[model samples]
Structures are given as structure tokens and as C-alpha cells.
Target: MKATQELHNLGQSLWLDNITRGLLTDGTLARYINELVVTGLTSNPTIFDQAIRTTAFYDDDIRKKTAAGKSTEDIFFELAIDDLTKAAELFRPDYDATGGVDGVVSLEVSPLLADDADGTIHAAEKLHAQANCPNLLIKIPGTAAGVPAIEETIFAGVPVNVTLLFSCEQYLAAAEAYLRGIERRINAGLDPHINSVASLFVSRWDHAIGDKVPAELRNRLGIAVAQRTYKAYCELYDSPRWSKLAAAGARPQRLLWASTGTKDPNAPDTLYVQALAAADTINTIPEKTLLAFADHGKVSSTLPADGGDAEKVLAAFRAAGIDDQALAAQLQLEGAESFNKSWHALMQCIVEKGQSKSTGTQAEQL
Candidate 1:
């Protein structure tokens, strides 16, 4: 059996960290769903930017929207929603079979709103309404501003994928935001089963400390961080607070391992995927990583819920002068900035594409 199937059977979800119109039109996404066990997908400004800039699939739509006097951002959203809605439909079977637990496709809110809580909340709501797919998750960063937005969005009955979290503490913050939202729903006599996921980035932790840490610690920090976070996740759900909510039909916001693609060339391609495997969690992996894992990956054991050796590994890093809390803050800030940069670049790409199309038409007429 393919390792992907094995992982799925082991109770971990495999979500593609990509979305492109070609994948949907060519049935590639569906093929992955059937053969590789990819239950869902996730997208961001970077992914969309790459998709729009590199492919001609969206050009006709871009030209149409440009002619309709749509703003760059508006045109981009129109294209994104169109693509994501289609992908959501393709995954609808898994979604239904799993009772809204597995199949999900995520679209992030404007990174420019990373620091604007109200704007983020509004954008999430608008996008969710516009997409109108129950399997779609509007992604919000786990930034301080975004935490409140997450709560408000969830309380308003929109599912969320809390992104950009780095450390266990950051994961906890996002989890708390989700729980608060669910608690508010219960208080208001609303259904507490709103879906959510707190995405903790994995590979970036190792990438950030790669050069700083010793050779033995290379490519190990991220998995250790996940281990620590997973323990916390299991503990939180086991608590009476979560138990009470669960009794009331509240679903635990799952712990998702994001950025699972190995960044270090010397590291094994399946390093993060193999190390972070656990039941009741999601791992959104890059296409390359997914293929690589399907080719040669092996899942020997699932991650220990009690966080085996996580403390010891973390202690070794601390002894090596890695400040966990400070670095987590830095990584989250850097991640938001990176996405903001991609968002601007994407808008610019749209503007240029629209202009080039108009120019081509004028030349043809001449």
C-alpha cells in the first residue's frame, strides 16, 4: 500500500498545500484524492501568486474582469473563489463521509490585514459568504490581532484555519481563540460544532535555526516543537473544559502541521511527514513532498500523545542557545511579512496581466 494510504488509515489527514486551475481541470486533484489519499488542500498568497503568474489558465478570466472594471484585488478574489469553490466541491465526498472533519480547502484573508483585527474579521466573513462552501476554511493568521478576528469569525459561524503559528504557545493562543468562539456559541444557545484548525508551522522552525544550531540539531527543531505542541493539544482536549464543550457537541479545533515540506536539501524529504504523524491532526504538505513520500516514505510510528522526549529535545536546543519564545515571535512576524510581500506581488502580477491583454487587443485591431 502507498504510504499516503497508510497514513490516512493511521488516522492522520493528508492535505495538499497547493491549488491550481490546471490541477482541477486536468483531474489531477481528483486523482490525488483517489490514489494518494489527499483529503483536502490549502492555499495562500504565495501559492496564488505563483499560479497566476506562471499559468495562462486564468488569463481569460483576468481579461474579462479587467474589462468589467474590477479592481486588482477584486479580480484576484473572483479568480480565487472560483478555483477554491470548485476544489471544495471535488472534496465534498470526503467532507461528507468524515462529517466535516477531513476534507477542507483553505483560502487566506488579505495579509495586509494581518494587523487589523476588524478588517481581518470582515474579510473572513465576506470570503466565507462569497465562497458559500461548507468545506472552505477562511485562513486567519495567529497574530495577536488575528486571534480576536478568529474568535469573532468562528462565533459568527464561519470555519477558520488559524495560520502562521510557530511555537506551542502560539498554537495554544490560536486554540484558545477557537475555544472562546465555540464557548460563545454555546452560551448563545448556538451549535458548538463549528470546524476550525490551528495550523502550527513545522519546517520553518528548523529552517530558521539551521545555521545557528549545531549539526546534530539540524532539521530536528521543527519536529520537536510539533511534539511539544501535540502533547499540549492532547492535554487540552482531555481537560474538563474541552470535555464539557464536547458533550455539548463542540468539535476540537484540530492541530495542523503546516510547512511540513523539508527545507534542507540534506534532510530526508519525508522528515517532517514521518516525524509529525499523529491521529486526529492534519498535515498540509507540498506537492513535491507528497510525491516524495508516496514514492519512498514510511511511517514507523505515530507521534506520542504525551510528547515523548519532546522536553529532552527542547532542553538540548535551549542548551545550544536557542530561545524558543523569542524565535517563535520572530518566525510569526516574518511569516506575515512574507505573505504580505506575496500579496502585493500578486496584485502587481494581475495589473500587469490585465494591461498586457489590453495592449495585445489594441495591437490586433491596428
Candidate 2:
């Protein structure tokens, strides 16, 4: 059996952290679904930027959209929705089979709005309505402002993927926001089962602190953080408050592991994958990580519900003068900035392409 199937059977969803027009056109995404147990996918500015810049697949559409006077951002979202809508249909079966628990494809709102709660909320609604897919999730960052946007988006019945969370506290905050939104819906006599996921990023933690921590702690902070977060997740689900809500038709907001790809070549390729395995959670892996896992990954033990040794590991990092909370904040800020850079570059690439096409046509007339 493929390691991905084993992980899926273990109850941890395997989502490919990538999507492109080429993947869809070539049937690669479908094959991953049929063969590799990839039930879902995720995309961001960086992914789309790479796809649009490198592929000729979107050039004609870009030309048409540019000629129509659409802004670069407008063109980008049109292309994004076209691809994500298709991917959503491909995963529709898993979505139906699980009653919307798995098989969710995520599209993030503009990273430039990461700090603008109102902007984020507005864009989320527009994108969700535009996507018009039951299994689609609008990804919002877990920044302080984004927390309110997440709650409001959920309250408005838009499924959300809370992204860029780096600590257990951050994950908990996002979960709380989700619950608040669901509870509000129940109060308003609306459906309470608003699907959502709090995506806690892994691997980056280890990359950030690899040289700062002890050898025993290297490549360990990420899993330790996830282990701790998973315990909180289980506890929250079993809580009387959540149970009451669940009885009233509310669903638990799932915990998701993002940035699971190994950053250090020296670390085990499957380090994050093997350590963060748990039922009802998800691990979004890069294509390389997915292939590597299929080749050599082995799951020794599932994450303990009790958060086994998480605090001990965290304490070791603290002793090394690494404040996980402060670092998590830093990472979230940097991640948002990185996406903004990618978004700007993407727009520039589109404009340049559009101009080149226009100039070529004019020359042909000569």
C-alpha cells in the first residue's frame, strides 16, 4: 500500500499543497486522487505566481482578460477560480462520502489583506460566492486582525482555512474564532455546521531554530508544537461546550499541519509527516514530500492524545532562549510579507506578458 493510503487510513488526511492549470490539464491531479490518496489541495500566491510565470497554458486567457481591461489581480483570481473550481469537482466524491469532512481545496484571500480584517472578510465572501463549490475553503491568515475576519467569515457561512498559525496558542485562537462563528449561527437560527480548519504550520519552526537548539531538539519543535496542539484539539472536541454545539449540529474545526515539507536536507524527509500523524487532522505536503513518503516513510506511532512530552520539548527550546510565542509571531509576519512579495511579482509578470503580447500584435500589423 502507498504510505499516503496508510496515512489516510490512520485518519489523517493527505492534501497536496499545490495546484496548477498544467496539473489539471495533464490529469496529474486526478491521478493523485485515484492513486496517492490525495483527497484535497491547497494554493497560495507563491504557487500561482510560479504557475502563471512558467506556463504558457494561461497566456491566451491572460491576453483576453488583459484586453478586457481587467486588473492583474482580477485576472489572477479568474484564473485561480477556474482551476480551483475544477479541482473541487474532482474531489467532489470524497467530499460527498465524508459529508464534507475531507476533500476540501483551499484558496487564500489576498495576502496583502492579511492585516485588513474588513478587506479580508469582503474578499473571502466574494471569492466564496465566486467559487460556488461546496468543498472549497477560503484561507485566511491567523494574524490578530485575521482572527476577527475568520470568525466573521465563518459566521457568514463561508468555510475557511485559517493559515499561517505557528504555535498551539495561535491554533487555539483560530479554533475559538471558528467556534464563535458557529455558535453565532446557531443563535441566529442558522445551520451550525460551518466547516473550517485551523492550519498550524510545521517544519518552519525547526528551520527557524535549527541552529539555536540542541541536537536533541533539532527538527523536533515542529512536531512537539503539533502534538501539543493536537491534545488541545481533542480536548476541545470532548469539551461539554463543544459537545453541546455538536449536538446542535455544529462540527469541530479540524487541525491542519502546513509547511510539512522538510526544510533541512539533513533532516528526515518524512520527519514532519511521521511525527504529526493523528486522526481527524490533516497534513498538507509538498509534491516532493509526498513522493518521498511513498518511497521510504514509516509511521512508528501516532501522536499521543495526552500531548506526550510536548512541554518538555518546548522547555528545552525555551532554555535555549527561543521564545516560541515570539518566534511564531515573527514567522506569521514574515510569511505574510513573503506572500506579498510573490503577489507583487505575479502582477508584474502578468503586466509584462500582456504588454509583450500587445506589442507583438502591433508589429505584425506593420
Candidate 3:
């Protein structure tokens, strides 16, 4: 059996951290679903920017939207919603079979609204309604501003993928936001089963501190951080607060591992995949990592629910002068900035393509 199938059977979800027109049109995504056990997908500005810039697949759609006088941002969403909706449909079977736990596709709100709570909430609602897919998750960063937006969006009945979280504390905050939203729903006599996931980024932790940490600590920090968070996640679900909600038919907001792709070339390609395996959680991995794992990945054991050795590992890092809390804040800030950069690049790509298409048409007429 493929390693992907084994991981799926072990109760961990493997979601593709990519979406592209080529993958969907050529059945690559479908093949992953059938053979590699990729039950879901996640998208971001970076992924969309790369997809639209590197392929001619979106040119005709861009031309149509541009002709209709759509703004670049609006055009981008129209393009994104089309792809995500289609991908959501493809995964609808898994979604139905799992009761909305596994098969999910995520689209992020504008990074431009990363600091605008009201704007984030409004955009999330608009996008959710526009996509019109039940399994869709609108990604809101776990930034301070995004926290309130998350609560409002969830209270309003839209599912969310809380992104850009780095530390266990950030995860907890996002979880709290989700809980507050659910609690408000229960108070208002609404269904408390609204779906959500708190995405904790993994590899970037190691990447950021790789050069600063000692040789033995290289590529180990990310997993240790994940282990710590997983322990917290298990504890959170076991608490009375969560139990009360669970009894009321609410699902625990799942812990999702993002940026699972190994960043260090010297480390094993499946380092994060092998280390972070746990039931009731999702790991959104890059396409390269997914195929690499399918080829030869091994899962010896799932992560400890109690966070085995996580404290010890973290202490050693602290001894080595790594300030976990401070670094987490830095990483989150850097992540938002990185996404903002990608968003701008995507807009430029669209503008350039639209202009070049118009120029070609004019030249032809001449």
C-alpha cells in the first residue's frame, strides 16, 4: 500500500497545499484523490500567483473579466472561486462520507485586510456566499485583528481556516475565537456544528531558526513546536468547555499542520510528515512532499497525545537562546507580510496579462 493510504488509514488527513488550473483540468488532483489519498486542498495568494503567472490556463478567463470591467482583485476572486468551487465539488464525496471532517478546500481572504476586522468579516461572508460550497473554508489569519473577524465570521455561519499561527499560544487564541463564535451560536439557538480549522504552520519555524540553532537542533524545532501544540489541542478537547460544546453537536476545531514541506535540503523529505502524524488533525503538504511521501514515506508512530518530550526539546532550545514566544510573534508578522507581497505580485500578473492581451488584439487589427 502507498504510504499516503497508510497515513489516511492511521486517521490523519493529507491535503494538497496547492491548486492550479493544470492540475484540475488534467485530472492530477483527481488522481491524487483516488490513489494518493489527498482528500482535500488549500490555496493562498502565493499558490494562486504562481499558478496564474506560470500558465496560460487563466488567460481567457482574465480576458473575459477584464472586458467586463472587473477590478483586478475582483477578477482574481472570480478566478479563485471558480477553481475552489470545482475542487470542492471533486472532494464532495469524501466530505459527505466523513461528515465534513476531511474533505475541505480553503481560500484565504485578502491579505490586504489582514488588519481590518470589519473588512475581513465582510470579505469572508461575501466570498463564502459567492463560492457557495459548504465544504469551503475562508482562511483568516490568526492575527489580533483576524481573531475578532474569525469569531464574527463563524458566528455568522461561515466556516473558517485560521491561518498564520506559529505557536501553541496562537493556536489557543484562534481556538478561543472559534469557540466564542460557536458559543454565541449556541446562545442564539443556532447550530454549533460550523466547521473550522486552526492552521499552525510547521516548517517555517525550523527555517527561520535553522541557521541560528545548533546542528543537532536543525529541523527539529518545528516538530517540537507541533508536538507541544498537539498536546494542547488534545487537552483543549478534553476540557469541560469543549465537552459541553461537543455534547451540543459542535465539532472540535481541528488542528491543521501547514507548511509541512521540509525546507532544509539536508533533512529527509518526509521529516515533517513522519514526525507530525496524529489522528483528528490535518496536514496540508506541498505537492512535492506528497509525491515524495507516497514514493517512500514511513510513519513509524503517531505523535503522542500528551506531548512526549516536547517540553524537554523546547527547554533545550530555550537553553540555546531561542525565545519561543518572541519568535512566534516575529514569524506571524513575517508571514502576513509575505502573503501581502504575494497578493501584490498576483495583481501585477493579472494587470500585465490583461494589458498584453489587449495590445495583441490592437496589433492584429492594425
Best by lDDT: 3
Candidate 1 yields a Cα-based lDDT of: 0.93
Q: Which 10 successive residues of model 3 have the least lDDT summed?
A: 357-366
lDDT tens digits, residues 184-301, model 2?
9999999998889889988888888768877877888888888899899999999999988999998889989999999999988898999888889999999989989988898778
Selected candidate, larger lDDT, 1 vs 2: 1
Error of 1 at 49 (Å): 0.3
Model 1 ranges with Cα > 4 A deviation: 358-366
lDDT of each: 0.93, 0.90, 0.93
* Worst lDDT 10-window in candidate 1: 357-366
TM-score of 3: 0.97
Query: In candidate 1, what are the lDDT values of residues 85-104, reduced to their tens digit?
Result: 99999899999998999788
Q: How many pairs of residues collide in each model? A: 0, 0, 0
Clashes of 1: 0
For every candidate structure, what is the RMSD over all alpha carbons to the true structure, in angstroms?
2.6, 2.9, 2.7
Models sorted by lDDT, best on top: 3, 1, 2
Query: Which pairs of residues clash in candidate 1, taking residues 3 or more apart in a chain or in different chains?
Result: none
With candidate 2 superimposed using the best TM-score fit, by how many Å does residue 292's alpha carbon deviate from the native?
1.0
